[model samples]
Target: MRAGIIGLALAGAAVPVTVAAPQATTVPVPPAKAPFTFQEVMVPMRDGAKLQTVILRPTGKTGPLPILLQRTPYGVPQSAPSQVPDSYKALMKDGYIFVYQSMRGRFKSDGSFTFSTAVHPDDPKAVDEATDAYDTIDWLVKNVADNNGKVGMWGVSYPGFAAAVALADPHPALKAVSPQAAWVDYWMNDDLHRYGAMRLSYATDWLYMLQHDKAQDSTFEYDQYDTYDWFLRQTPVAKIDQDYFKGSIPMFTAMLDHSNDDAFWKKQDWLGALKKTTVPTLNVAGFWDQEDPWGSWQIYYKQEQNDPDHLNQIVAGPWNHGGWHGRGDTMGRIPIGTDSGIQFQQQIEAPFFAYWLHGKGKRPDFEARMFESGSFVWKSYKHWPPRGAVEKSLYLHVDGTVSFDRPDAGEACRSYISDPDNPVPFRPRPISPTYPIPDWRLWEFGDQRFVGGRPDVLSYKSAPLEHDLTVTGELAATLMASTSGTDSDFVVKLIDVYPDNYEQLREKPELGDYGRSLNGYQLPVAMEVRRGRFLESAEVPHALTPNKVIAWNVPLRSHDHVFKKGHRIMVQVQSSWFPVIDRNPQKFVPNIYRARPEDFVTARQRVCAGSKITLPVMAE
Candidate 1:
């Protein structure tokens, strides 16, 4: 789940639109079939660089409407559509002047585009995303016909980053913004690296697609259908560039150049650019968002610190990276029971923009709104994580069974030999490429039974819950472990194991012989990887002394999920998670990127008795 510093090629449904409440009695709702006239224009930035923008407005309506703008690296639609897209239907029902603009250095826009989100508001000469957004909004209100003079910005993934940066230096006309699935910190937890362990397949494929061409989205043709085999063959990620790209991709070279969280990456931290909360920001996240899981949470937390106006809000659902904009009903084969995406659009997103931009319905009464998957209900909270949530530890037992109780004093550790030659696949075999294929989107919620009984993976599962157990907020794993090698990665997953009879409750849809059913499914709720070197600090990585036990804190990020009465909670720990997270050479090197094949070796890893997972359980 990552994106190039504010770089992603989003689908049309992924396009950002304003969120508003249902039509208020005072505000007349626009007809569902409002005809829109499309016009293309070059909107000039402060530095004289003109951005290519597409403006869509109701053809004959003279009623002034707030402008809903989406700034993106992805190109805009070439022509006006005969009808409003389904994605925008819920929000557009109230009437809006939709504007889509290509960011600088993309498509027909002028100037160079760097894959970074750093905005320099102090330097007059520095023109960044914030400046471009301010300039675009400045021009739209003046030039666009019948504009209410208020503009709301939104975008998914890359465009989400663009919208978030605008909060750093917002224009007066910019009334509201929703940065959905936005990327904030690159090195820590975003697209590129997870605690310094490079994401090989994603970085290789996404960067190649992004930089191969400037005017259009490019594709990287793979020789093998199964990318796992293709990536495994290219051992030591350095070969990816040495053989295929040959340094053609600039970001790819930059990533390799700065493997550590150096000044280069720190400068790209867009979260730092947000000096104050000047705009009413709505940060949206998908619980199953594979591309950007950590970003929205960080943005929401950062804004919350100094939100005096209390304009900052957040909404999370069971969608996968802009899945809310599409069919919100189901993820993979797991039915969410309702169209959560559209529900969020109509209930939260739409009303947010409506109350702020158009003065329509009432403002959202709660600070955070999350859809609980197990209970299948929308939960509103006065404070995120809720005020009464308690912290409890679920200890990992050496006996392969987990419980709230701790392990015996004699039970010190569980051992496994992690082999780089046969690294565990992040997903099932025939792993599809991140792009061009949609399988990557649902891999977060993919059944974990594929790796069942693997020797390399240590499974610790709790018995069935007596009642529904709801876990909200941040989750982390405290692993007291040691490695035979100098360095290693600890991949920890918090899974929900369904009861054997789980299939009976769900719809019995006919499968075409090959489809897998959802019986006794092992759904990973929270999972993350922590490199041993970065345990102390992300910027400075130190090699571990062989055979010495150390604590590895693996942050599983924030989640709002429920473990039903009949379901069991499980935790699986492993050393490697394959090409998704570039394989960590068990032996430490100053730069894993520069490590040779000899540096890769099978090493015995251990999880000691003291290890436990901290869950933010909702108190009764």
Candidate 2:
């Protein structure tokens, strides 16, 4: 599936107040008997910026309650809900005041909106997200009626980013923070770009709507429904500003001018600023999150670098961006076997906040908790990569098969001619806008059969496993490859190929269509694209020696999946992922965004016999 970068308005949950092992805990937050009242507040920041905030307080007056703050760039809900959303029902019984606020530049808030900004450690006067969160917490503890001074913050996607900002020099009252599917570094692996390939579809459209009218919502309108055609018509990134934006939007110009990971992008590397963690942090993630998926794990690892308190824990599940809000039970065309969404909300999230804010429970025992797909099992561990995990390489063979054994010396290399005019589609044709449609986000799970046999694509699938093959951590694709042109892009996808005669499970609750027969289903476990030029240096550019094989190391992020018996492992290599990523001209150009139409050229690509994908095999 295509990874998206949008941060949506989602629910919040914390670990339940229980000492029972995670899997053994499942009690939901019993319905609240105390009445609650919602109040609007324009909280003044340290810089005097008044943020529009809504405070939901329990009227039980059962002594003062802790405050749970969720700062978001998306508008705050205008009215309080009659019932807690099912996604957050588990947190309802804890009885803490819920504070929701819109960040600066969003509705009713007083500043300009920024997609992402670097943490300014050098400047004391810098007014970034960290400072905003600190100010919000300070104000809430000071003015709110809540007698308990403790506070906890959590949010999904963009708001998840807001939750992360609270960890840096957190306010004295802030105890726990969860940044789920948060956007961290834009250039590295978040939404905007992957490695150096521009996420053309997401970047342009997102910026256009966001920057068009800061005072109100302004989404870009397409002349036709098929966004694939809409983006394909806009060749070369330079034409976009002149034809549509006319250079009015600053973000658009910056995307083209700052094509490389230069200072502009470096300033957007928020994760690099995470030198330490001052508060207990719960970094949540989704294995299939289309947006901001990479940031959560990156932030978690960085915080762990100096975590003496052992306060950092991670929970990654098989869901898309913000999918844990409710849909973690099923994704794409498969049911994840358990109500993972409810489990995380009740067993993990509700308890995490309850203990920190109210001192009602103990910290979760596991350092890492994940929902292992395929097996439909939930796993908790003392350490990530589980303890005895070993690295293994699956070599590519000329016969279109992949295996752990080394390829024979006589094994020939495979070659494919890539044409810029007809680059392989990232998904099936007629792709639509990234928003306003369900299919837009589900594209990540589109049937691979559509592009598996294309001429420009090279595939290597492993034989059906006789036993379960479980991969628990990160993975990388190491391809000894070269292209006929000076520049190119390489997309490597790690796929789970199900066997024939597969059928849905009837043991658990029926997933309806999601539980449909899985015959021939090709699930994408992990995939990432690398811009060849960036291979030399993400900040510097260098063209490849024509037809000279060079190593391209592409990390497929982190995943936890079990390739069950009879299932096959597959790796699909192609140059273009369509509007998901901008096309690489294959010809060297000082600035790819400015390349002319004629600059596009055909290139012959080769994956040498030594090519292999390195996978983390967890010891049973």
Candidate 3:
């Protein structure tokens, strides 16, 4: 847990889940005979609280090396790994004193822990993640022996947030940081919620895991194999705690209390803290990142605003939450043609730190390095969305076809009945827990055909492309339609449809029973949901006018992908995405969280002919 999948320690991305009873332990005992020697110490914070820190120095090396620090709410190690973990091998080869520390009120660390990264740097009395990170670096550079004064920080997910927070008020010794798959704003597009609709499974599972115990990460045990069934069986959002959690998870309760983007959620915004770029940053993201995908881009752009020194750079690949830590040659059914993970680690990440922390290599010159899927090649750009990319409209036709040209005169719209009682599953059923379920990580890349034909889903596809079409920037869907319900959730997905006669992949022993053929596979490039209530303004949400057409803008985020020749570009519009996205209830209520079971009802959803999905197409 210390050296690998450390983000899983707190956020539960790919961590192994122990189905047995949950137990509480003060400190985690690390494996014996690790390549690095482990030493535990209490690092004093500015607020007079002590944090549990573990320092791991290379076993045989003795020369002075810069400190590579990672602060996490996840538990720190009592001992080091028996060998260099895959996640650390690339960086370890460069040599450094690795340090891991449990955040305040986590494990043996003193002081209470608030799961928010919001920090107030102006007030001396305010101590948050930023302050804690600052204090920890101050203590490490001054107290920890080894003779090196420089420090660098890197982490994935929550730890990534901590890495970004350090930039608010960085320590003098801190030189570089990488906030991979980090969360900049929780209320907008991160873990808990997307727009205004809650991410039911992730929010429910992660809250129970992170807050259930201060000493260890816990997973909620389910009686049913399919979490989709398990979640649907629960009461409304307001009664979830009463029915199961029993107030054990305070974060869930707080989320329900703040159903809207009000002050409670607004206080957690960290963009203000990062108004200026202080430390050299490598903001990493994944085009297919299921958790915390939006943050890395948000951070990169925020830093670019005032970065006259150009210390900011980004690397986005076809990775899941922490997929870059593993072998990234293949993602689900698609072969990336290159080991993107290693490329990022050895070429980009390692070099960035080498230049900034150890002064060993030249600084990265490019502003963005992205892995363009479909083409399965690495792309370098001086600016993201590359200067040559242009926004083009892909219109939806009532005949169930999509085209770059405007739709001819025909039926006004296509309709579907979205029933909350039988919501559309985000993935094929027999769905397992969000964490530990190997399939959970690859769900984003799963074939959309599973739900494409459902009565609740409306699918439209363009004819086979004659040439490779590359989309390299932000994507959005402008839906001009109406709903029978006063409140609705519009889910838009940009998909890549493989040709019926697509070339089949060679059967590898590692693939086992999974299909090797890519024929007719519907891979989602980008998908997002926007609630009708918050369409106008998130702060003042009101009931929508029933049966009245209105424009709904659904942001599909950004991606660097190509629709190869003969492959069709598809767009799928739906209402509910099952437990992945909480049921909208359809009928508007003052607080959807408090809506009764009766609030759930069937609503007619439509996609008008004029509706179009704007893609940032790279100019040929």
Model 1 lDDT per residue over 1-620, tens place = 46653355453236445876577578787766647888999998778888899998866656899999999887898988887788777777688999999988889999767787787867988888888898999999999988899999999999998888888888999999999999888887778887778888888888887677889988788899999899887866778888889988989988888988899999888787676687888999988888788888899999988889898998998788899898888877888888888888888888888899989889777899899877778998899868677888899988888788877778868999999999999999888888788888889999998887799999988989999888888788899999999999999999999888776543555655224667688999988899988887778888889989888888887778889998999999999898898888888788888789889999999889889999999964
lDDT of 1 at 27: 75
**lDDT value, residue 417 of candidate 3:** 96
TM-score of each: 0.92, 0.91, 0.92
Per-residue CA lDDT of candidate 3, range 150-239, in tens? 999999998899898899898889899999989878889999999978999999888888888888888888888888888887758766
Worst 10 residues of 3 by lDDT: 505-514
- What is each predicted model's overall lDDT from 0 to 1? 0.86, 0.83, 0.87
Which portions of model 1 miss their true places by more than 4 Å?
A: 1-34, 505-515
Better of 1 and 2 by lDDT: 1
